[model samples]
Target chain A: MTGDTHYDLEILAELAEGLLDDATARRVREHLAVCDPCGESLADLAAVREMLAAVPVPAMPLGVAMRIDRALADEPNPFASVPVGANGLSKLSLVPALDASAEVDSEELATVTPIRRGRRVWVATLGMAAAAAGVFGASVLASSLMSAPGGTLAEPPATSVSTPERSPQRTLAYTVRASGHNYTSRELSGPLVGYFGPEPGTGSNNDEQLDACVQDKANELDRPPIAVDRAQYNGSEATVMAFWEDQSLDKVRVVVVDDNCRELRQDGLATWN
Target chain B: MTPPPEQPATPEHSAVAGARASVTDADLLARHIGGDPQAFSEIVKRHRDRMWAVALRTLGDPDEAADAVQDAFMSAYRKADSFRGDAAVTTWLHRIVVNACLDRMRRKSVRPVADDELIEAAERDTQLPDQTAEREVSMEVTAALKLLPSDQRAALVLVDMMGYSVEDAASVLGVPAGTVKSRCARGRAKLAPILSHLRNRTDLTRVSSAKGAELRDG
Candidate 1:
């Protein structure tokens, strides 16, 4: 205490900050009203607080920020990514998600990480198609295009079986490959003709034996199948169903599922520009 | 305004990132859970500077501050789904970063490797534009803060420097509001005489306290 007659800095500081009890703060205020040094000490403490508040915040170093970015990018998938890439889901493991798999070799299964599960192939393709079509471009580009099942993937280009996983830097590689089918029209009958064989027996939902599979496909797409035809996709007896995604009817998603509702990977269709 | 975009960030990725710039922090965390790979990164990009400031102010060193911030983000990334969302995301984040800083301070205090941080801090990292004044202020601030204990330093940084309310500071520091208030008060009393010379305020008399003499000689 200055002069052995006034309160020390701590009491005065607490009084200044209103941290003291009302009775003690009143006594300190009365003492400070009669004493000059104690008042000066109190004012100086306030200045210190002001100085702290005035201190400018330093900018985060760019190098440090970039380092954080690298560390984040290298982080492996932490948890589940629900819509697609969910573990143990129905994904085409061996067959590439693309229509042109002529170069597919046996080793393609070991090296390529099927993170996409081939289920969102049509979804991501539709998203990118929306970008190309420029109809619902902005919202579709950010939302559906972004979450469009593996719209961006690092696995091997399933479109070309011989390519092998070229670039391993997830998100930036093969995000939007050229669509193999336009999917603009609903006429998959010609390509799916082989599924019905030489004499197509009135193939309009006539496959009463595969009624459950067709309904499962319908339930998955949230709509009734527009056209269901029998096919041997990837050497398995499969049902190829074309789904009209929305009321706009500008987009069509084709799903190839076997006797079970599991989606099968079928890659081999001509280009549709 | 954009801080002059960095390199290796592709135009398409930049555009996509820009499109998602308006996403709320909670939504970004949710999207990360929903399997959007870029969602978490956007969260990082949005909050790095704020967390960096809190970490740097608490640790008073750049390298350690960087590590603490990294640790906090990595922890947050792994624990995104577990966030209960009761508090503001910034509050939860500052808690992580401040906890990281306090942990580092505790470990550093216990370990033999001391004073090396001060020597290395002299080397200076990067020179940000218009950072001269801020650097000087932080240097003085750091020196003054080193006089106090780490708890007091954390409380003062949040309450005074960051303008956090006492309750918010207490929340970030995981302490009672009374504890935060008392720390700030005791810290200010000790800092008043020492920082008067550093800040050179006009209205204050320069009384030489024991703490002031110690700081002056050191």
Candidate 2:
């Protein structure tokens, strides 16, 4: 060992960690036998490592396991019984309607079925509807009184629906449901084809008649509807649309009305609650 | 038809259970891919605690660690069919958990721990009259760990804290063995001053001396 020479701190540190090649480690050890400073540095590094090794392995938090279970339960098992389409949308049979006398609220039951379907695509339906409904209580069923005077689709605001102050419990329940069912951006378009008729036009209808129908619906509902369109609900011709009452994406108003400008029943449409 | 009466456990059932208990991780993963519903859950139950330990030490926050571990297992479950079997299942899990933790840290921009908060954490642990000396030391080590760069901390956590070999740590980090070694060296250098107090404690010093001797002889 050279009496005047000391190894670099990195080399000594590596030696301390036992990370050097056997030959390099031997050289460093021989130097350490004669060099107090290098030996002391190695000793200090070893102590640091030992102290770190002593840190407790904390028990996994209880909530983490519960959250994982919920997440896993919600996850669509690729190998499970559910059939998935080529586009990744699961083909779920329409959930059987719940008994009328069951304790489950219709809206709550409405929220539960799609979730059970385990289809990432369908989750967006409730999420979008819950977002549009905002603080409004039970969806107001609006149906178009009739087609425009000439049997053409009516203008925007076709029928009026009112926003009732919904209980906080309902809002929280819906919010919790929505948060659990996340949809991919691609799945957002799937709901459009299913709820609205093929190719629903964008940005508040350019057709004056459609605009008038939307205006009529907004005035009646007392909430402005966005993306108003002449659409179909379950093979029945209807006007389908959504509106936002607040800046939050969660606060949105959605309305579906029959061709005659009357409210549609909640059960008739798959996307609305 | 009435349901058949329940049968008591038989030698055949016990033999089946014994055989199943010896199934390898890869076999379990294969079973999951082949549509066995219980296999993946068994895998999760087996390795979750160790995965949690690696994540918690790497992230230094229980909430974030929990989130990372949960994400890792979910990803593992989803992509079980993709396992090429090139590495051990634990190694693959380590990679996933580490990546998840790093992704989370990157998303948050990993704000530096404020000096006051570090002081507060240290004071809080030390102030408890009933706190054991070992617990105090553990807390101190954890606090010191938070001071290192995330990558170095991860390497040190995997190798030093979790008792993984440097080569295994390299595989998990997706870095070379040399890189792992360098990171460990640098991390230990940085932690030395912070953990200096433990150097004087007889219990730790003796343990450290033995460990040092082992490393030197190796």
RMSD list, candidates in order: 20.4, 19.3
> Candidate 2, residues A223-271: lDDT per residue as tens digits?
5543444433433455555554432322335565665567664312122
Candidates' DockQ values? 0.19, 0.20
B-chain TM-score for every candidate: 0.74, 0.80
The TM-score obtained by chain A of candidate 1 when compared with the true chain A: 0.30
Measured with C-alpha atoms, the lDDT of residue A250 in candidate 1 is: 33
Off by over 4 Å in 1: A1-4, A82-273, B1-18, B110-137, B201-218
TM-score of each: 0.53, 0.54
Model 2 DockQ (Cα-based): 0.20
Worst 10 residues of 2 chain B by lDDT: B1-10
> Which candidate tops lDDT?
2
Error of 1 at A3 (Å): 7.4
Let me know the TM-score candidate 1 reaches against the reference structure.
0.53
Q: lDDT per residue, candidate 1, A1-273, as tens digits?
A: 224598888987676556788888777766666667776676677667766766655445434554565456446547644333466332322112322322223143222222233121222222222222222112222232224244343121112222233333211111111111112112332322111111101112333446666655555545543344444343345556655443242344567666666767542232111
Clashing pairs in 1: A99-A268
